[model samples]
Target: MRTSSGAGELLVELNRDSGVPLHQQLESGIRTRIRAGLLRAETVMPSTRALAQNLGLSRGVVVEAYQQLVAEGYLVSRAGGKTQVADIAVVEPTIAAPAASGPPRIDFRYSRPDVSEFPRAAWLRSVRRVLNETPYRSLAYIDGRGTIELRTALSDYLNRVRGTAARPENMLICNGFAQGSRLLLQVLAAQGRTRLAVEDPSDNDLRDVAQAAGLEVVGVPMLETGIDVAALEQSGADVVLVTAAHQFPTGAVASAETRAALVAWATARDGLVIEDDYDAEYRYDREPIGAMQGLAPDRVAYAGTASKTLAPGLRLGWLILPSWLVEPMAQAKLMDDRGSPVFDQLAFADFVARGEFDRHLRRMRPRYRILRDTLVDRLAARIPELEPVGVSAGLHVMTWLPPDLGEDALREAALQRGLGVYGLAPYWVAGDGPAGLVFGYGSLRRKEVVEGIDLLADAIATIRG
Candidate 1:
């Protein structure tokens, strides 16, 4: 253990033999103490004269260090010439950065759409049109349920595209699917719903959202097709959240029989089904599955977002709720940030109504499809032992790792090579799922996809020995 001299009342550590400057050492030592809360706010600090004399240092060195810290706002100098630790909030970090790797050069982690391909031109046009045509009073605190105009437009669009049964009166505009789910879950919890069932191996923040709304999160097993209805029934959950169209991470489209069973389950138990129609538009193999909300509108609350098709930065999403839950959901939303920004809602309303949203999706589907195909082909060529599961739809493919290859070892080795990829184990609700890696190619071009696979092979070779 290293020893430090106690200067005055404050014990600022310093090393004379170290190459670092005395003033710099003094500043850092004090700064660390302040941030660590040992030197708390309003605690008087020793004068530079006393500190320098006590540490056997020249007064000028202590003066320089204290002035620099004051300039940096870590210490406050008062009118009476008293220097004290400044009032600042600093969160202590819990995780350390990896020492063996540089920043990821080829990021393949999932959940984001290709931001480079976002329809900027059409979105700008829509915003300008809304600003010009819409009544100025519409910008005022209108309704907690969002502007009726946006809800109406989303209703028409989702109904036509996703086979959703939505109405403007029952729909609510949210900041994103996150806030929407939170609001709805709050409403559910208020109505005495205690438990929420989510599919195992889910990769999104839905479970966290449910828990925040005071509902116990239960994980039902996911089948090859979709969530296992039998397990969901046995999970003792009154509410369920599902990605009905295309399951995230694993691209499993729920079968017709499974869909029928889910509807039946909801009706029989008087349970609520929250349908997250995530990535419903980008189906490369066959027609995209329709929303399950059309079949059981009353039993299911359907949610859709502009996040995947447009951009996540927009923080725009909509929810189509049942008639009975609409009012309570609106009240919940009112309490939670007073119903998302009106300008964004109105602009998105105009975007959906103008057919530009449809145009954007049509263009992006092929681009993402090409990337998906490249990743699959490259993986097959480089790592044929790895089996690609659920590749028929969505922006990413979840590949099951071979029994011999551990996910954690491969992931770290891949990271050291500057290739970012996520293992499937963390997504498992109960830590009992097959080892896999989620390869998201939505943001990557075709050439990068090829190189990423090459890097993956090199990383695999490192851990294989």
Candidate 2:
């Protein structure tokens, strides 16, 4: 039915014979009107009695619908006053015009998994099992260290897969690696540890995390082997963050010598190391390297996430802190939103325990390796001049551009040609570095990877001209 109010025109259609309840139908219709901006802010709604009488329904039905709308913040009700649409911001609908442009047809941005490969059936089954079997006590406010069940599962999993010596008591589940890093920084800041040293050409977002927590961020130049341990020691910074297994963007695995030197540096300086073991599972070449945390568990605080393995939306990550930092980090976690959602933690534990996680990885590793190989092969065939720097491991590979080509110009040209490519300039904290591009193949299919590289070669040619 359609009705004109003092504020504006409100149209609501009701199907009496439909299986949907009348109140819910009414609620949905009104909500749609509000969202569509047909009903503007402070628009007065029709009186429930009048609406019910006009629709030939009981006054109670209209009242219930209006109450629901009010509760959902779509409508506001004052004390014994008329109900009106809430002052909510609504996006204006786009007009039916010619399509201007869209995002790149193929994206090479890093750190995202192929979401199409997510094990939906297995995850759903795990969620169902967790819901069915969990005790009522598991539903309440639990430890900020996360459920012991998940921590224990993670400890065992890490020990087996990544060679990290973790115990349930020393592990803390976090929202994600981002949150885990922030919590560690918070605890460090509390202890008056003000300076944080990060890999020079590292992920900028992580550097910002330490800076946001009031720590002075220093950049240690990345060497061919790994982060420059000698430069790090010379910089006099006590706390260092390293992506040891597969360095981001550069993909430089720290050599055994560098690893030993880093451990010695930490031990001698009485310092701590934050190990970001991100995306260490999908190695295409040799077997994946064990985490640096295994070398010196007392000095390293290891962080890992399911962002690359399952999906970033899961927001599930864990931290394995040294004995000294465990209590402080736990207290920081407690103050930072209590803890990650308990249901997800429990469900993930069940997923790991049932071997679904490992099976999923085993299935995905080969697929990802194929995609990576396809990317490498196509890039070599099409753009032989660009040296692919980091192709051994991780989701992405770094391609060093010809000295004549500017990274910014090439990236812009590639984008114009419907090829999404990221430049390496943003990853540097020292303000300058080698010009290159980071190409991630995790989310791209084989054909898409080939087509994207072809387009990229064309873009590079266009830029050179």
Candidate 3:
């Protein structure tokens, strides 16, 4: 029953006495041969009945194992042809390769926007209207501080929606939050404020951006309510960057008491608070949190972005500056990139002014609420060891892994199972503290989220075992 030495022939030996079940033994033997260069591409294996006869096992046992390998894309069969081993050359395992290539099979990573839900029809209509109605001068290199019409529209919108004291004149449109932070840090540093305070476990990219702009970043402890006020005072930082509406990664809303206290501290020290109101609109729990910039506009350099609301590829964001800093920030804008795309900004202005933007948000909020609940429910059902954090709002959840599963080991095992997960240790300043995973459900479908988390549970179980 064994093949002597044909170029396309393979030898799959099944051991019934290894204590491993016959089917599992066949599966492991085939996979190990594939990995060890024993089973080359285009090689054909003996038929299930032939192999079973050769190994003195029932035909059903060999067939069951062969079926599994085929289901996993490792083998192929034809109507009247031999079941050949699939081209193993093309099947480089996902975990064996670099992490940044394509989308992960089961991505538990964070900060993803659901592009499938963007208002395509409304947005296209706004773009067409902007080309028709906007004055020719508005399209030219006009105001370095962005278009006035857009700012005016935003003035009303922010006031109505977020309760921010936004004036058209005080707002400066820039590339996005990153640009706003870079310009603001440069301005503050020019005014002799080189050291700034940031949340301890804040976004690592934010920290990288701040440092890249030559500003020294100081760590301030972040609590469930907000940044620790006492810790802020002790850090001796003159400028503070905060995500007040909902803290990034953690999803903590700043408490009213802490907000007032922070304002008081800033006012006392003649300091400034840079508020990054990112992803505040998609609150699943209560009404949208009011902008912290509203409490004391002059003391708060409020930065807002459309990366989450609309799309990140748009690369559009705006900042409402304090009056005294408007011209300076505008000049900084001119120095930075000469301002964002004029047409896109005009189109966005028309989009927001025509009330299409708000409508899109309203439509998406319910869908996201369902997705969030599905993620929670699935993880709860499959992975009881995984505790879902940041359940209140935002596009993702940060689930803390239990202590038994070390973050590094679990991450590797997940990658092997074609799952993507971002560990929390990288975001911490200490770099060796509490570890967890950031699961982004925005771009994922409801069914995918459920299956993905279930797969994740299996991977974790394998690692634990």
lDDT of each: 0.85, 0.88, 0.82
Listed per model in order, the count of residue pairs whose N, CA or C atoms clash below 3 Å is 0, 0, 0
Q: Ranking under lDDT, best-scoring first?
A: 2, 1, 3
TM-score of each: 0.78, 0.82, 0.77
Q: How well is each residue in 13-58 modelled by candidate 1, as lDDT tens digits?
A: 8899999999999999988887876676777788888898887889
Residue 240 lDDT in candidate 3:
93
User: Taking the tens digit of each residue's C-alpha lDDT, what string does model 2 give over 139-178?
Assistant: 8888889999999999999999999999999999999998
TM-score of model 3 relative to the true fold?
0.77
Q: Rank the candidates by TM-score, best first.
A: 2, 1, 3
Candidate 2: global Cα-lDDT?
0.88
Taking the tens digit of each residue's C-alpha lDDT, what string does model 3 give over 1-465?
Answer: 222224323466666578889889888888787666566666667877777777777989889998998898777786675776677533443456565756667676676788777788988898888888877877678678898877888888899998899999999888878778878888877777767898878887767766766778888888989999999998888899888888877878899998998899899989999998888888887866799899999999888888888888888888888887899888988987887888888888888998988998898889888999999999889997787877888898887778788788877877777778778887786676687888888888888888888778888878878
Candidate 1 TM-score, C-alpha based: 0.78
User: For candidate 2, what is the TM-score?
Assistant: 0.82
Candidate 1 has an lDDT of: 0.85
